[model samples]
Structures are given as C-alpha cells and as structure tokens.
Target: DTRKVAVFVGSLRKDSFNRQLARALERLGEDRLEFDHVEIGGLPFYDQDFDEDYPAEGVALKQQVRAADAVLFVTPEYNRSVPGVLKNAIDLASRPYGDSAFAGLPAAVIGASPGAIGTAMAQQHLRNILSYLDMAVLPQPEAYLQFKDGLIDDEGRVTNQDTREFLEDFVDGFVEWIDRQRG
Candidate 1:
C-alpha cells in the first residue's frame, strides 16, 4: 500500500542541503510513498490570539498535515536547534488545544549538514517536540547525515553509493514504521 507523507523542509533557502535531503528521500521511497511538500515558509508566526480564528495559511498547513498518512521532518541545525520557521509551522499545526493536526501521526526525522555532527541537535529538539505533539516517531536508525557538495544532485539523486545505500535503509525503515503505526 502507498502512503502519503507531508514533507516539511525546515530551511527556506532555495538550494538548502536539508531540502536536497528531503528530495533524495522522495526519490528513494517513490515506490511506496507519495510525498507532498508542505509549504511552511509563508506562514505567519503562530499566535494564541488567533487560535479562535487562525490565519488562512495556518489553517491550510494544519489541513495538509491532517490529510497526510505520515509526516517527515527534514531540518537544518541553527544555533544548535531547529530553525525558527519549522518551529513556527509546528506550533501552527498543533494549536487550539484538542485540535492538533499531528496527534497520533507516524513520523520520522532526518537531516543533513556540511558540519561533522550534521543536524543532530536540531533533530533531537524536533523529536522532543514531535513527542509532545503525540506523534509516533521512529526511534531507530537515526539519520544525521554529513552532507558534502554534490552528495545529492539537483534532481534528487544520491551521487555516492554508500550514501545511497544508507538512505535506502532509512526509507525502508520509515515504510515499516508507517505500516506498524497504521496496521
């Protein structure tokens, strides 16, 4: 069975490494997973004042997430944590108390960075948030990839054999994770 994944790329940069990583995953999992790239860059800062009447963009974000069979967070580390835009998007989707879009959704987190440690700290922070939001996050085979130039090409192809194999393993794990969650 095929599952639809709402993919959230944490960075706004047009050619961000994390986005490339997300695209690579999309390519790897194309047979079993359909990826929908959720737009978070245009969302306004989440506000409780608007909880009763959320902004249209925020509502759309929540709807997209709610429609997905699973969620994938591809993030970049900034200041040793998740980027502000991603946090804002999460807050928007999980607002208004009992109406969270993320609750009980199967999820996975992965990231790539030029730094040695990759996006470990940021992924940790994001996992904490996902737990709080009640997502069933995958716990094994954590991916904190150290991205080099041309590791993933513009067409979302993994250039190196080892990197491709690792990502394939991650994708397989994610597909199993989703099945376990929904089974």
Candidate 2:
C-alpha cells in the first residue's frame, strides 16, 4: 500500500531552494509514497479566538494534516529559526486544546539554503516544536542541504551527485521509518 505524505513548504517564494528540495524528495519516494504539497502561504496567522470557528483555509489545512499518513516539512531559516508562516500553520493545526492534528504522526524535516548553516538551526527549532506536538520524527540522516547554483536543474532534479545520493539514502530511511511506524 502507498502512504500519503503531506509536504509543507515553508517558503512562499516561487523559486525557493526548499521547494526544490521537496520536489527532489518526491521524485525519490515516487514508488512507495504519494506526495501532496499543502499550501501554507495563504493561511492567516493563528488565533485562539477563532479556534472554534476556524477559517476555511485553516480548516482545509487541518483536514489535510489529519488525513495524511505522514508529514514532511521543507523549511527555510529566517533569523536562525523557522519562518513565521510555518510556525503559524503549526499553531493552527495544534489547537482547540488537545485536539492537535499532528499528535502521534510520523514526520521528517529537511531544508536547503544558500548559507553555510543550510537551515540547521531552523530544523532544530522545528524539531523542538514538533516534539511538543508529539510527532514521531526520524532522528537520523538529517538533511540540511546547502544550495549552490545549478544544484538543482530546471526539471526538479538534484544535479549534485553527492547530494543526490545522500537524499536518496535519506528518503529511504524515512520510508523505512514510516513503514516501521505503520507496523
């Protein structure tokens, strides 16, 4: 059986490296997993007052999160942490006091950046937040991709041989973890 993975891209930019990384992961997981890119760009900032009467976008986002077999976060670092948009989405989905959609869900995080840190700090921050939401995140083979020009081609393929191999291994490990969790 195929598992449905909800992919959350943190950046709203049309040509974000993180988005490209997500596409690469999708290509690598094509056989065993089906990917859906959940749009967070339009989600309004989370508010507790609207918890009972969630907006349509927020409700749709929650539904998507709840229906998925797993979650994949492709984030970019901003000021050494996760972007406000992603954090807002997390807060929105983890609301209504103990009715978090992410509770006990299997998750993995990966990101790409032009900087040397390669979104390491952002992933760490996200990990802490996901821990609070009680997600079963994969612990090894952490992917913090450093983006260089031509690292990814126009066809959404990872061009660097080393990065390609590493991402293949990373996705393999993620798939294995998801299967184990399914069992």
Candidate 3:
C-alpha cells in the first residue's frame, strides 16, 4: 500500500544539507511513498496562548502532519540538539494536551552535519522528544550522514553511489517499519 510521508527539515538555509537528505529520501521512495516537505520556515514560535486559536499557518501545519501516514525528520546538529525551528514546529503540532497531532504516528529520523559526529546528538535529542510526543519511532538502520559540498546535485540527487545506496536501503527499511506499525 502507498503511504504518505511528511518530511520536516530542520535547517532553513536554501542549500542546507539536511534538506538535501530529505529530498534524496523523497526521490528514493518515490514509488512507495508520497512525500510532502512541510514548510516550517513561517511557523511562529509555540505558545500556549496560540494553542486554542492557532494561526492559519499553524493550523495548516497541524493538518498536514496529521494527514500523513508517517514522518521523516531530516535535521542538522545545532549546538548538540535540534534547531529551534524544528522544535517549534513539533511543539506547535503537539498542543492543548491529548490533542497532539503527532501522537501514535510512525516516525523516523536521519541527519547530516559538517562535524565528525554527523548529527548524532541532534538525532538523539529529537528521538527523546519524539518519544514524549508518543510517536512510534523506527530504531534501526540509523542514518548519520556527514555533510560535504556537491553531495547532492541541483536535481536533488545524491552524487555518491555509496551514499545513495545507503539512503535507498534506509528508505526501504523505513517502508517496512511503517508497514509493521500498521500491522
């Protein structure tokens, strides 16, 4: 069966490595997964006051996330944790208590970074938060890609064959994980 995967990229830069990874995952899963890159750039910071009467953009974000069968979080390491924008998006969707859009949703995380750690700490921080959000997370085949220029082409394709194959395998495993969650 086809599944809809909502992709959340942590970086806001035009050519962020995490964004490139997300696009590569989308391309790899083109046949089995319908991927939607949810825009978190315009979302306001999460505040309890806005939970009741959320802004139109926030509402749209919630709806988009809730409608997806699964989530693919592609993030960058920002001071050893997730970026503020991505965290804000998460907090925005999980609001008003017991009405969190992310609850029980199947999710996975992968990240790329310029540092030697390859976003390891950031992904761990995100995984911990996702657990609190009650998301069913895939635990294996974790991707911690090291970033480099020219890794992804203008066409959103990964240039390195080994990296491409690894990502493809990760996508395949994610598909299986989603299926397992459904079952």
- What are the lDDT scores of the predictions, listed in order? 0.94, 0.91, 0.91
Question: In the order shown, what is each candidate's alpha-carbon RMSD?
Answer: 0.7, 0.9, 1.0
Give me the runs in candidate 2 sitting further than 4 Å from their true place.
none
Model 3 clash pairs are: none
lDDT of 1 by residue, 22-97 (tens): 9999999999999999988989988899887888888888999999999999999999999999999999999988
Local lDDT at 75 for model 1: 95
- Which residue runs does candidate 1 get wrong by more than 4 Å? none
**By TM-score, is 2 or 3 better?**
2
Output the better candidate (1/3) by TM-score. 1
Q: State the weakest 10-residue window (summed lDDT) of model 3.
A: 51-60
lDDT of 2 by residue, 97-151 (tens): 7888899999999998999989999999999999999999999899888899888
Q: Which ten residues in a row have the lowest lDDT in candidate 2?
A: 50-59
